[model samples]
Target: MAAGGGSASDPLFPPRAFSPQGRACLALGSPDGRVRAWDTQSGRLRHEYVPSAHLSATCTCLAWATGRPTKEGPQRKKRKSEAAESVEECDLLAIGTTVGSILLYSIVKGELQSKLTGGHDSKVNCVRWHQDNGCLYSCSEDKHIVEWGSQTCKVKCKWKGDSGGVSCLCVSPDGKMLLSAGRTIKLWDLETKEVYRQFTGHSTAVSSLMFITERPSSESQPFDGITGLYFLSGAVHDRLLSVWQVRSERKEKSAVISFTLTEAPIYVDLAVSENKEEPVKLAVVCRDGQLHIFEYILNGHCKKTITSTSIVQIATSGKDDGSVPTPIPILAVAFCSDKQSLLLVYGNTLQPVIERVSLKTSEPHICLVRDIQKNLTLKMKTPILKVKTPVVKSETKVLVPGIPGHSASVKSGSSGTPVSEGKRKPGDKEISIEEQLGAMDIDSMKAVRRGGLPQTDSFAVLLVQGLESNDKNILNKVFNTRKEKLIKNTVARLPVYSIVPLLHELTTRLQGHPFSALLMVRWLKAVFVLHASYLSTLPDLVPQLGTLYQLMENRVKSLQKLSRLHGKLYLLITQISASETRQDVTDVNQTAKLVYEEESSDEESEDEMMERDSDDNWEEEEEREEQDVSADKEINGDSDPDPGEESEEEEE
Candidate 1:
């Protein structure tokens, strides 16, 4: 399912909700070189493109930065005098891809205007355009937030810190304070680019942040001392919705109060009502199935101290159990206020569903009966709430290109133009969109997803969708996802599908990434294990064992080449050492003998050295004979020494 709130003007799919600017539409980036645009009202494909065809990278994030048209080179754009008045320009869609590149596509022209690369070393998280002219901000998991000049397509400045990778960021209404939401919320002065205040209330990583105007219109009433700089932030886990009051003059942020809902919030968006009676409210969808609406109320000197008290206002149909809250998570939410207090919510169902719940009479109650108002009336037309997790459903679309208004003048290269920088023969054929679609595995293209991971990560969701899908083009999308993920875990989770198709895909999808060999080996091992235990029982699969043999053979050949190179490197290193030391002998015993010979030469000739080492043998013999003769003279004292010993001594 798609996550993140769209412009206030647009609602979720079947996009009936509208703003004066234009009808709401959605731009979705997928793995198969397509950026799809869908009409919000009719839930139909509007525009699609394959800007970076050779990149073959999955889309990570998407943003619309409304500003003056980016200046394409003289060849791409028309002169001001020749401009057509019939066409209206829209905001540029900054499609952040998995390869750390951004595509600036003109939604109006339905063509690529510019492309950016190498600004971030990792996948782009969020790309937001400051209301300021031509200024945009992009953040990545690489811990980099780069400000870009949309017109020049160049990085203007970079901001980084120890607080860690940026999860989300929101610009204050005044455009002075840039609040970054991560493990902690940091307020940075946009001009100085210095972090002045760090909000530490959140103990874990925060998912998103948005600024809300607390005060009413100046024409309606005056909020003399009220702080206008307020923001709402939510976390990725252990979620709490914190409403912060920013006192820029005081250089501080005070957490007015936070509510710990039953589930961690997946997305948070704020909407203000034009109705004079209605206050500013927040719309949230959580991991656990639930839809929440909160109103920002200020009282008692703009209170700083917080409490754990619940500020819940669940809309139940009956009077008997109006207090209990249900955990039905909404897929998308829109707080519409042309003149009415309506909240539109979409659920995960077989077909598309949009449930509108009126909140005009819903006054929040803190403690049960102490603050109960007239009544809590809600029309629960559908029961879509799940107690445990977010509701997710699969979306399967065919690979047909140029859906309706979307035209495919596919472009490539760093500039997002049709210029060819890659090596190509003059007569080489440029693959048409049809051929590209034909090349993809058609069967695996059917996508399915079921959890929170898919909501945040474009790559994971797409691959998991393909893994569980029944389309032949599964390899095209799944390969991009599988390249980064663990092969073992993915193979274990994949539903029974044709392994032969996916294995053939590894040849193309596994290119341009590191550790391809390792991934292939792990994949082969998993396939073998699955085949022996389970897939082997199936009929035509018996002949498919050749796929496993081919994988193993390629692996063996690679290992052999690797070992051969290793031996060559070792031999070269050993030869260099031997040449420097002048030692030809490698045998341990030979080395020992050589050392001994050197020592023997230092002392004397070999024979003389041994005799010297033995020492005084003849002197000992002569001494023994003399002692024996003396003992014979003193016969009684030394009867042991005999005549034969004395004779032998004389002969010596």
Candidate 2:
């Protein structure tokens, strides 16, 4: 989907909620009052629930109840029955709406269990579950933060200090302090219900605030030295993001980590890694539909900025460490205005592109490594029968244009007979012209292409085939080949989608041909080798590989249970060959096409066509109408002067 684009004045404000499981995101719609749950990993909507309990009022905020274990005690007969009636172990979702009401819904059974009213005089802006205490806290524009218990909706405590309405509210990690920002920030003691501190840094109304804990100390000691808990807040008028740290010095306590903004940040979200080694990263959603991720250091330095388009909300979850948090942080989720949601989990890795370049004679070769882990696993369970591993003939010839009289032979290895290397015999039909050209002028081919000449190399085409056997020896042999480097190089330069075209081309090239296990094995081995090499260059690719590896492992188990040894082997080989071949071809074609098109397009200029197309037809028509109307007015004025005006002029 295309990312959303608009001026800052027309900013979209969709209600967003974080899942209690931290595995998904919920996008709440206004007026229509529908809540849609989206899977974080896939960015797809999992389910939509519109509780009958919240029919008219729009849901403003949502919070998931953190299931805390109950205290241990002896089970009495009456108590057990009462417990069953009063408490049900289910996922509870608390939703605050526009009509000054709070609705608690049971998600497991998909039903609204309870409704509470009269807590807030105005619309509830935000709601959060307190981790330390089992109660829920909610703040509204009425300048009050009300606490609610399990059955009653009565306000346990009301924090009212700000002159303007409260725009945002958050509870500290320890749950001892509650922070609210409106025109100013007010810190309230959760236990005592007293205003403990007033933060007067922000010049304008504060939009959002979050509490973050730093990475744990290295020594096997508690985080006593880290008494200061940091808070990130953003302002609407100034578009500035400020970081404040609360620390105790001697007997007195103060808030630090103060900063100002260079640009106006509308929506701000903060995430501190739990890993302790990674730094705290803040994802800011700006009014301009731009998302910026900043790495915060202890000395108040902004280390790096990662920007994206049309990001509405940003969240992070993971180990509290000071490092570059992974794409799948321990916990991270971002909501986009474009109907899609992003979830950052614990183990997401980036995919790598592979490029194939010949090392023999300085020729640029490119191929994409296709991940066939899925297909391979399926084959492992249903191997093809009577399939022998085909011998890979290293005699494969590559044709290179622009470089004359250069020949290179790719050698293939098999268990039985090996073809002797020698000069090509006269009138040999098996050796194609393209192959001869590739073998003869590989270096010149690379040089000419590099020199902006048209490419005529056909060896760049990728061929994928499936193996019919699951022999470890075959797999080892296929992966342990010279083409391994080529495959690796190609895959590193291509995306997953580009590999599809290459696979289609290969299937067409080898029509009606019997499946060869050896060839398939060779291809699979080359692909695996390439992926392994690319993994080193792209650490983000690990998550993708991990997913494939898991699938392969599952297939192996299924094959063992089904007792389809040969079928499984065949399936594995075929899938591997097809995947690798498709990916390689797609990568080469895309790269070459892009390079070729860019070079070729500059030769011609279409100034006349551009001029003709640039004419504003709508404006021209309007101009013609205006000219005609002005001429009519001029003709009318000349044809007849006003009698009253003429008489007045004569009298003067």
**119-140, model 2: which lDDT tens digit per residue?**
8878777777777666888888
Off by over 4 Å in 2: 1-11, 42-44, 51-56, 68-90, 219-226, 250-267, 274-277, 300-652
Pick by TM-score: which candidate is best? 1
RMSD of each: 24.0, 34.9
lDDT assessment of candidate 2? 0.53
Candidate 1 per-residue lDDT over residues 97-143, each given as its tens digit: 65567878877788998888768877666666677665777777788
Quote each prediction's TM-score.
0.47, 0.41
Error of 1 at 499 (Å): 12
